[model samples]
Target: LGFALTCQYLAARCAFGYGTDLRAAVFRHIQTLSQTELDKLGSSTLINRITNDVTASQSGVNMFIRLASRAPFLVVGAIVMALLIDWQLSLIFLIIAPIVGFLLYFVMHRTIPMYGANQKRLDRIARRTGENLDGVRVIRAFARQKQEDERFAEDCAELERSMLAAGRISAVLNPLTFLILNLGIVAVLWFGGGHVDTGRLSQGDLTAFANYMTQILLAMVQLANLIQILTKAQASSLRIAEVLETKSSMQDGTETPDTASEEAICFEHVTFGYPGAGDPALEDISFTLQKGQTLGLIGGTGSGKSTLAALITRSYDPTEGNVRVFGKDVRSYKGTALHRCIGTVPQKAVLFTGTIAENLRWADEHADEQTIREALETAQAAEFVDAMQYGLETHLVQGGRNLSGGQKQRLTIARALAGKPAMLILDDSMSALDYATDAALRKALAERQGMTTVVISQRATSLMHADLILVLEDGRCVGQGTHSELLETCEVYREIYEASAK
Candidate 1:
């Protein structure tokens, strides 16, 4: 009880720290996540780690300290106390102890790998379910609900099968253990009868020996239980180790930037690939966007548009080239320094469960209400936010569920602008809004002083206003010029413009 209480107290404190640190780490990880990685694991498994996996690990640790630690002490002490009663009967314990050890050894070895597979299968199920739920609206819209349901059910079945396999192994061990223990007790009685008949052993001594035999068997049971706990823990440890040991594919070079760029963003023959991918996502990409200039990017899906944004912010360093910002290579700026300078609104607008003000503060914690209001106005969000009951303090549910798609998109843009970053990136963020809203937002951004902007979009109206536009296809820069120049000179650019106009 004392140990249990102590563990409960420590668990409460550890839980708070675990929650805070893991939340921050996961958030940072999401920011740096590439599309390839996201596609590989999906959101649900990530969510489970942030919730279920961590919970399991903490529970396991708590059990290890509370139950596993004390049980062994009790078991060992009981065994030693038993040995002092009768040495001849203690010889019976020595025989069965090794047998129990061998049994536990077999169980542990078999169950450890099974438990590991079970947990991974659980992660897969979580990922599938999460993907289905998040995209339920779209699934229904496309009449693919049945298809998604089937996929989720398949994952669930696989998880169940894996878990049952482990359970079956664990379930068999106990009965086998009881049988072995009973046999040992019968042998003790058979041997002790002759001693008692010849008056070689006292009646009390035989009774004590019988009781001690029970203790020895009980100790074996404890050892078996400890092995089971360790099996589960071993599996969990490996999963956590996978995440902790993963080296970020992007790392800074020892070569310092001897010189800096005057431009806010510069890509020098930049090349990058998804980790372990065969081909580069962005190859031989080069660009220079000075402070206060708007550089627009246009391309088909998979044209490395967002990859370029990631490179600019140093989410991933170019595999074969340099990405320079603010007269220094971005690698030179670590942690807050690099992040503070660049603000990004991704293609999918993301929001947390907080007030509008709180979400904006994510970009700039020191930003005042006035700064937030200005950003909202710039993104065309202030009018709607003002009409709400709480305005800046208006509560936002997770993923902005309370708001329209366009509202969420505008809120993301507002978040980017709130930081007043030297460089702002909108990665197809305006797709949800009407052309009117998109145009107004762009115009407002244009009016902002000394803010360099990058826009990745498919819309002609969006990129038409840019100082320069780069057209991309198949990971190569096929066109680079003003809107008119691209339309006249680049066939791909003209085809895109004509298609959008249609």
Candidate 2:
């Protein structure tokens, strides 16, 4: 019993290690994937593959290690002993083995596909659950609780149906296996009893033969259970392999940007469309900004403002023409090299659970307290951070749920500023701030010398003072000039400004 316990412990430890290594490898690979690839494979599906699928495969490995050799060895050894005891009576072995093999094969063939479909249903349920959790506020704000609950219930119901369908097929294996073995045992009893009565077989040999038959039956049942586990593992491994084998669409570059260059950014006839999208998000866009210049991007919703910013960050390569930074093609800069030069505040303000100082340190791990405070001052976040009990040491919950919207936005901006990047892109990050705070942030940004800035905003007043303003409409560059120049030459700009004026 101690030996058995030791073997079980070793098997469990091996499986645990296997799962940890597999999850780590998958997570590392996911970091290499481009934004386009990530969008194509949704977060929920990837999460399911890395977690649930890995666990299933790990369980299979454990079971295989424990029973794979023992069950078959026992079955084969029992058959041989029965043959020696009475070769004629051992005919039952041949008939029963084939029938059991066929039954297992039939069940495996039917269940493998069902298991695959069941995993997909699981992905759907995961996706729904994630959507609900992430958008709980929106759901409640719109009074969509009932509708969302109903939708989630439908997903749960579908998953239940899928699991039940697979379970029903698998349930037949054990009972049918037992029935076949029981019938074979009855055959053995009848034939062995007749032989014993004629003195062809001893009563002792008949009893021993029956014992061997019982051993074979138990071994075969264990084998059947192993096959069920293997089938599920096979299905899950296929899913895991799909993720492992997927080559990232984006390749890393070796060279870094030249810091000495005067031109900060240039977009030359660049056009881009999302993967599997019907139309281009940006078309024939061309522009250039010199070092220290402030460029403003103004557009309505879906006008490709953020998409254009993504191009500068090399989040997705442009489909046509080139995007250059620091006098070289943006594609030539290595991933980390480019990221180091550009600090970006995305439309959504995301913060992890940590102290404010810890969050700011993400941009520059070696940044000192003075540097963090300076960034906060520039972002107009100093006032609030200083007022908090612990100041920069104040702890934020996941997504900064404890903070107001404007405060989160400011903190994100400060995190970006903490890096002292060569170029900064604020992608509508000021929407949460009041007008005075927005002006203060911009004024502070203006004080930073030789830092190229791109501000994407709907508020015309925000961009009116920028050195150059580009008006975008339906993915086209409709106007490019100073704010006053666009108001005169561009009807779209005039309409937008007039509306904002109201």
Off by over 4 Å in 1: 1-43, 68-70, 73-75, 252-261
Per-residue lDDT over 267-303 for candidate 1, one digit per residue giving the tens place of the 0 to 100 score: 8898888877888899998888877889999999999
Return the TM-score for each candidate structure.
0.90, 0.96
Report the C-alpha displacement of residue 347, candidate 2, in angstroms. 0.5
lDDT (tens digit, per residue) of candidate 2 on 1-502:
8856776788888888998999899999889889988888899999999999999999998888777647778888988999899999999888988899999999889988889889998998899998889999999999999999999899889888888988998999999999999999999999999999999999999999999999998988888898899899999988888888888787888999876689999999999999888889999999999999999999999999999999999999999999999899988889999999899999999999999999998989999888998899999999989899999889999999999999999999999999999999999999999999999999999999999999999998899988889899889999999999998999999998999879
Total clashes in model 1, counting residue pairs 3 or more apart in sequence or in different chains: 2
Candidate lDDT scores, in order, read: 0.79, 0.92
